[model samples]
Target: MNGGTSTTTATPNPSTTAPSAPKTSKPGRTSPPNSNSPPATATAPSSASTPTPPTASARSGGRTEHAVSPRLPHGASYTLLALGAALAAAALSFTALAAQFDNNVYDWLFRVHPAGHRPHEAVLLAFDDRTLMDHGGVRGLRRTLASTLEILAAAPPRVTAVDLTLADPGDPAEDARLAAAMLRLPGLALAAEMLPDSSGWQDPRPEFLAAAEAIGHVHALPGPLDEINRMIALERAAGRDRRFALALEAHRLALGGGAIVSTPSDLESGGVRIPSRQDAGRPLRVHYRPSSTVETLPIGALLADPARARALRGRVVFIGVTALSAIPDRLFTPLSPLDGNRPMAGVEIHAQSFETITNRSFIVDAPPIIPVALAFALAAALAAAFTFTSAPVAYSLGLVLLVAAHTLPWLAFLGRLVLPPFAPVAASWSALAACAAFRFFYVRRQLASSEQTTARYQQAFHFVAHEMRTPLTAIQGSSEIISRYNLPEDKRKQMGQMINAESKRLAQMITTFLDVERLSAGQMDLRSSSFPVSGLLDACLRRAQPLADRKHISLEATAADDLAATADRELLEYALYNLLTNAIKYSPEHTTVRVSATRDAHHHLLAVTDQGMGMTPEEVKNLGRKFYRTERAERAGIQGTGIGLSIVRQIVDLHGGRLSVESAPDQGSTFTIALPA
Candidate 1:
């Protein structure tokens, strides 16, 4: 029996919910109508029987001499497999693509502008050791401010921004002087440090506040979850006003007259997204210049005491500490993780902020679609790969994909380009591993079941073949005796014919039953050899002629003598014999049964053509199914057990040959076998 569709087919139970039985007649000549015989067709293999070729529509290939079984009748396995594959594909696709996650949006507001970009544009008036030496400790602070005020008055900066907070004055005189100096400058702005808490309060020393009318609130953006600087917000909330970020504020002040760069290109990111604490975005572009380059410098120092008490003039001057652990300190920057960790002075933070805000060099974001798509695609692929691939290979491939997705986004960001980031590469990979593992185990279980069923079928075939041998032999012997002792000429001839007919029928029944069981059980063995196929065909024809002669069906061979191949000789012969016998059996009484063999450039072909009550297209479609008789064939009173062609298909497959059929209900049927030359 061809496992072709047997494993995929089920038997209709006669006792339960059976269809209406077709009418039948007693067997004297031909049955009046249909009997219990499946319509037979050309041989097809027991394996796959999908109609890749048009002929497959006519019949399935016969079962090969291998562990072949009937196709399973249930569609459950196929449905489940398809469902699993789709799900796996979806999951793998996602994991391989999507990107969306980002943490902490408040950080972008608190940009530490780099001094690189605004070097010549801003001045840093430090209350250094020299300035302090020129005066005294508390008194020196006074001299430094008095001097700064002197320089600012001479050459007023575009807009002086004093990055100083005087909540607590170590020296009141210097603080007072600074306040006095601020009042003199027409457009000087004093930075007020906002409280780090949610209250959003500022700590501008009363002295400084009383002197300077405008307060430039200074607040660093919130750090990402990982403490990295990746984004900064354009807007920030202050006491009563929704204020621009420090960088924005500085830029606004610089362009107070509204004559600086106006393009979106001027601001990094156009202040769209905020940074995540996890990491800083790509580095900003900066152009640092010495304080002397700006008008707010040492009033007049083309080349004085190179590093003097007063060098800043006509520019934004920020003052702060630079020592290690000045106060509650944190000075991390994106320049380099290891170096950025060191505590930084307040003045440098202002420098960084000023440059960054002014330069507008910032990190772009990962696109929204990139991450989402990646997640879906990777998830699906991983699921499928895990389903079929080995654990190590699946994991390894998954790892590579994950790394690729992750690295790709990061690299794009570094290049000032945006891509998606929220991809579930890691998750998808793991899921595939898990899913594939489950499938691996599942397939093993199914294989075990199939193997067990096949073994049981083999046992049944052996037992049945053994059990039927005795009765068949007895019937043949009895028929022979009755034929030999005929009383009259007509009686003798009739008896002889009956004996031959019965003996042939019995033998055929036994062969059909044995072949079906053996093929289904996968117990058949092959004796392969290269031989003249012409001789084999001749032998099969001689053996099948008696049956053909009885029916007045003419059988003839028409194969090219040159055709030959290296295949299982016995199996090939049996398969060929089966095809020829079927042609003779189903053929109309007067039709010519023609068998032919030919060789092409790449293949050797064998064909059997019969003019008989053939099959409809639909009936031809499922030709090799065990016990599946065509409606037309059954209507023709064909005496068949329905396992012959199926067994033939099995043998053909075992020899690496193909079987196909072409037939129409009214037209004669033709079966072709192709073997690679």
Candidate 2:
């Protein structure tokens, strides 16, 4: 019965049995029978059984086998992402939306940190509601102005600037009286207006213009976004006809009427350098004096007493309408109430402009590059913080950066610099958010990878305990029988043969496991060679035949003798053997597992078809994932660790091949490996 069984087991073909044994030693002496020795000792004599050496191309390729180069370290990648977000936000600072936001911040800084100790060089003589009503309203504006000027002449101011436009002919008698009264003042600057269409200036009447020493435009330049009067254009021109601002004209006359010197970036007049960039419309950021420090004498009150005229003696007097209902020249200011209930009058705004020039309290805007550079520096610092420090330290540093972004503007404002808060604030916030989110997700991914690795190790432990225990027990039992029992020579030789076989099996199992792990990690180099596909299939079938016979399953293979493949032959054999054994293990008794090979013009295809409990499409899709098993297989209590197919897929992929599966519920399954020709 034993001889007949041996004949049946070896009946597949002589070629299969010949390749299964080591070429260098006799079949019985291929490995040592002593299980007490290390596994390496059993494998050492079977050098001819080892896989071929790696091809020259694979050796030269080394670590470059991957199509893509390794990525930058996590710190570098995170820094770049954060910096990109910050740069995007900084670029947004120059847009109109950020400008609008900056305007509000500017106003906030102004209110929080007001100027100290103004020069008090200008006074307001207002045409208040009481004065206008007492002087017969708007129709009597010229008469009221004439009467007020006559009183001011008693103690003439150093320079008197009117914030009114007398561009058209009024009542002739009243105009004559106004001209006569204006001539009594020592120094006079008359206010002209830009036409509504912006085509030209509306100069005062010829008679009145001749009476004034200097003529200036009364155009208050408000912010285009909010219409808030934050700045005043120092110089305005229309078709070769240029006019200084009313406040500039008044200041020039007050300081002995010096000629205004101009430059692209600044204006110098009255021995004062104004930081007003001509390309930016010569904008002079007005440092408005506190309202309480401004002295105002209502025209009606001045006329009633006339003693208040002495208060205007050494100061420039800005005379204009202050009645909110009478004139529509009211506008907002940085110092205006937040609710917008109080808007400064245009005349008062001009007076404040004059005070700004006199006090040399100009708020200069920071250069365009300042904010951009700050954004970059802040982003870099944040990147470094996260990279080198712990979480609490990094987050605390991030909070400090945020505070710096807001506080820097205030400090600069105190130094008379108008630093827009938008850019730095936006950069800090965007970089913080981006880095924080990246770190959050990166940590999550790392944690998930760690958990997966732990689970995989646990599964590997199960595989070792389940698959290797049988061979180990057989080897240990046979070794003990040889060491302790006094048996006949033939019986001892049989036990020794069994121990040797199980040792070789255990060694091969360990080698295959290690090879799969190394290959999956991209650390193994493949030994490429060309071989006949039929011979490879025969070898794999011979190895899996014993397992198939135990379950009463049949192994069937079909391939042409001329069929060939170029790949790692040992790995391919191992993959095919795994597939065949899995098929036998999962299939019902009396079923057949088919192994076939074919070739097309560009590729060789190897397929294994099994008559077993089939898988659903979802199960098929997830088949080769490590530790993944179908519900049916688990329910049937199949003895598997679910890692065999994963190892097979890894081996095929390393050789530039693809493994594909096709199946449906309650039907047989087909696994195909397509290798490059």
- Estimate the TM-score for candidate 2: 0.81
* Local error of candidate 1 at residue 323 (angstroms): 1.8
Model 1 earns a TM-score of 0.45
Q: Report the C-alpha lDDT of model 1 over 288-401, residue by residue, as the tens digit.
A: 222223222322231234344334444555554332422343434343223434433345455555665555444455545565566566655565555455768867766766
Candidate 2, residue 85: the lDDT equals 69
lDDT of each: 0.52, 0.79
Model 1 worst lDDT window (10 residues): 44-53
Off by over 4 Å in 2: 1-80, 338-340, 387-390, 466-510, 525-535, 538-566, 580-594, 609-622, 627-641, 661-670
Work out the TM-score per prediction: 0.45, 0.81
lDDT of 2 by residue, 314-361 (tens): 789999999989888888888886434578888998998998888888
Please report the candidate that would top lDDT against the real structure: 2
Q: Which whole-number lDDT from 0 to 100 does residue 620 have in model 1?
A: 78
User: What's the lDDT for candidate 2?
Assistant: 0.79
Report the Cα lDDT for candidate 1.
0.52
